[model samples]
Target: MAIKYIPYFKDAIQGQALLDNFVRTKRILKYADNNEVKERIERGLPLYETEVTEIVGKESDNLVIRGECISACAYLKENNIKVDLVYIDPPFASGADYAKTVYIRRNPRIEETIKKAEEKLEIEDLKTFEEKMYGDIWNKEAYLNWMYENLMAIKSIMSEIASIYVHLDWHICHYVKILMDEIFGEDNFKNEIIWHYSWGSRIETQWNKKHDTLYMYSKSEKFYFNANEVLEERIISEKTKNRLKYKGAMITDRNKGRGDQEKALPTDVWYIATINGMAMEKVDYSTQKPEALLERIIKASSNKNMIVADFFGGSGVTAKVANDLGRKFIHCDIGINSIETTRDRLKETGASFKIMDIKDGVNLYRNPIQTMDKIKSLIPGLKNEDSVSEFWEGAINDSKLGLVPVYVPNLMDSSTKLLDIVLINKVINLAIPELPDEIKKVIIYYIDIIDKKEINDFIKENLGREIEIELRDLKEILSETVVDDVLEYRILNNEIVIDSFVSDRIIRKINEYNEKMKAQFIVKGGKTKFIEISEEGLELIEMVSLDCTSDKGIWHSDEEIKINKLGYTIENGIKTKKFWDGKIKFLKRPLRIKIRNISGDEIIFNVI
Candidate 1:
């Protein structure tokens, strides 16, 4: 069934009208209370705040935040944290689910098996599974609304001289371009850069989609752009060289007597190669942009020591590039994978940054996708009903109210997380009216509320229908029990030896994968091969570190080893291309050990 809720910006709100509505009402859509917003507007207070979780390295101006982009922008704006440049490679709305290839690391405990089968093990022979990082699926109207709010939030925190490079692909770039113009002003439009790359699947039916669009816009008329900083080496032809030699001083004053190996300004069409497999810069992140691409953008738009911010910091390419360029950076993303990847990457670079989480009350799981997947089983009696619309998650059978349709917020969409007047009005005016006549009650689950009393009173006043409205706190049913990974370790002669490691999540995922494979094979009338794990289960461990220094607050990686997808170990910030020896030799007595699973879930153990 069709969703009955009317979008805020319906067909009537087009172009200037849409812009005018945002401007006149000052209603930049956000997941906050109307009263709080009004008070902030009246008192000139920041609309949002940030909570620092951990400080990595010496305290500096760099920040790596774990939260949604909208909330991150709100925090930055509230703190008056303006940046000179912003490069965001957000989801391209490709209707595709992107995942990271999770590889089972080589078991160091089984040295005899490894030595015998070393030559036989190809890259495909290694056990690997795909873990979904995030989904880029979106409804057109919802995508536009989300992008509009994000653009507005980002625009508010940008410095007058700041430049923003929005990296998107063919999926929804055109739509977002319109929103960008409305939020940042059409006059501030700079250039539409086409980043051409040569690594994607080829199709016989159509031309290969091997490039992405980067829309560059400035916050104001006078913005920074340094062509000299990002100049490309000119490819001179012999004919052109001879002509230039003959012309000598006759050429234009700028090019007069220029050498053959001259530097020229790069064009809007950048021909940078995509990061291929086996590339050192490849961090195995699905949406990771090439460092070369970010380098050019950062150099052209910003200077050294200036702050560069990336709200959609996938794999922290922008942060790393900015750090290498001697510029401070602010990296923000909602996924735990992104934050961990970025944190480890920046740590390798020895960059000092404070990690922060936006106080948005959505940190129930590693990310929204996982949370959405797990939310189904959490609520009792919440089952899929054929009668209800897709907008409603499912229906609950209540003894008193019969079949009550339930509306749960799409955690992936930040706008839906907070239950405010706008959302309540939508439910009352549109959604509840479309429910089946027999349905007596409607349950609305919320992540956060603006004000419970105000919302309930509004619902009572505006909900003219005789339906019982029940507002349920999603967080109430989201209580999680931490399952600690089993580890067997001991200090032997100043060396930490881990004999066995078992991750409950990894084992469960493996069983699930095997079961699915077996079912598929059964359908095909064939036998299925299951992935066998050694009793030691050392392959499940992705990285192992020993903190010989501190036992309390911040974790210091004194000695560490990270196993890449190809089964090579990166030891102590250096890629050895060698297998892990299953032991960490420490100079001091080890106090703690941290082991991360193949899926990025880490657990720590205190040494006795």
Candidate 2:
């Protein structure tokens, strides 16, 4: 009997263009909404508005983008760039929150604050902390849907003769396999590779899951796979040599009857060591894969200069190995840390690429409190935090007057509004009149700018009582304030220069975190000292690496250099920790540099 996989809720996948495209494309058939589906497929998927931030190498060599994977794929498709090979190592849905341990330098300015505390302070106190990287906790349904959308986007940009390797663990591999089968067709399913390692925890009652599944599938039967490129050499034993001559004449004797060796192409099982603490390739990322593993997949499925992509580009091992193997790549990840780490890794290899970010202002809209606070700053006499309410038409503290709300649509589309006529009528006729006469003043805040005459007509037509209305325009306030600082760089002679370092930003952010920490301490009634950095904050730089040329195999000059806050250099196989002069200089032309701070925060930039 033939075997088949059925995902948890396969029937629920309807009207989603991504899932439909897989079946529609393979069978040359149409779904129910064929027109919309065809139009979407033809026009390519739409992505968040993105702007290119930096370009390190040549414009065509590689791309490192910071955005969600599905959006990144849409961006790729819109540009007419198709990839021949894709290897994604998405979150394994282990329900564990992964974090990175960062060591922050004990600021000298905090020494006095520590001593003034009620608790005795020690000079040897540790300042290291943990920060959550990404959340892998997801219910099965949400995970499947998220993966389905991304996989669909990925599939749309794949060349007809391409291969995709989806890396997953035992937790959700079975479900994902069924998803792939539904999307890519069962006949095209190729291998279920087992990548075994030996290091994690072992349960007393259950067998240790030391292996991960890598699902390899081709877009079509004509997909490329070069076996010779990834073949492993095996030594011929005497027994095998004797068996080789079983016909008494030897089968054409390519080895001159010696049977000395044979090339053993890799099977579905791959045994590669996980990155250890001391491994040269280790970059301290929690989910970093081994370079050897990526190398084999890249070589076997792709050729030099062909486009290779990894959407869940955690640790950037896929791109690093692809660059080393002489392939153009497009790496995408949503995390700022992932983007920074990948940029640095690519720069260390001297690979030229562009960094882009989604330009849509959705993040601003999502934070209502911060958005409201910013709006409050622009309006006079609205400084009282007690008077502000996040919801519309809410009573103020001990006051009969309540706050009213209005909104313009998104900046991109101003015709929309949060409070339509019906909702406005409810607030004016129902909520406003019920308030006591003492609440004569109604503070009206507009989330965005709109025509004032329309607002006046609405207020005049609806209100029955004499109420003083104050209006504040959030759009005007946002326009006057700077949104974000865009970073750029250039290489002059043997030196790299940038617009500005992140030192001040780092200090400001640390201060903000410290303020929150202080709030927690106050609630707990515990003694804690506030952290602060000194004027010479550049002393926080822990390490810097540079790739002067577009060669992945060699770094221009990884010479031993010293940095403050405990920096180390490796020479020959020994590691020496020292504080040396922190002067970094590199040859110009296609330069990439990665600068890391003591707190493990890093930035990767390219100088054109």
Best by TM-score: 1
Q: What lDDT, from 0 to 1, does candidate 1 have?
A: 0.76
Q: What alpha-carbon RMSD in Å does predicted model 2 have with respect to the real structure?
A: 12.3
Per-residue alpha-carbon lDDT of model 2 for 1-608, expressed as tens digits?
Answer: 00111121213334443345465453432223333332333333445567776566566558888766656776676667899999999988889877765555433234543344324444345354455676676666546655765676787788989999999998989878877886778899999998877877789988977889999999999999998886655546654543222112122233454446565445676667788877988877889998988988999999998999999897899998998999988898766667767876776676877788754333331122233334444444343433433324233343344443322232211112222344355457665666556566665545422346676789888778888666655555555653332234455676544333345434654777788889989898998766655554444555556655544432333322324233334221234552223344554444556666654445555544
Whole-model lDDT per candidate: 0.76, 0.61
TM-score per candidate, chains pooled: 0.87, 0.60
TM-score between model 1 and native: 0.87
Estimate candidate 1's RMSD in Å: 6.5
Clashes in model 2: which pairs? Answer: 57-352
Candidate 1 backbone collisions, by pair = none
CA shift at 596, candidate 2, in angstroms? Answer: 7.3
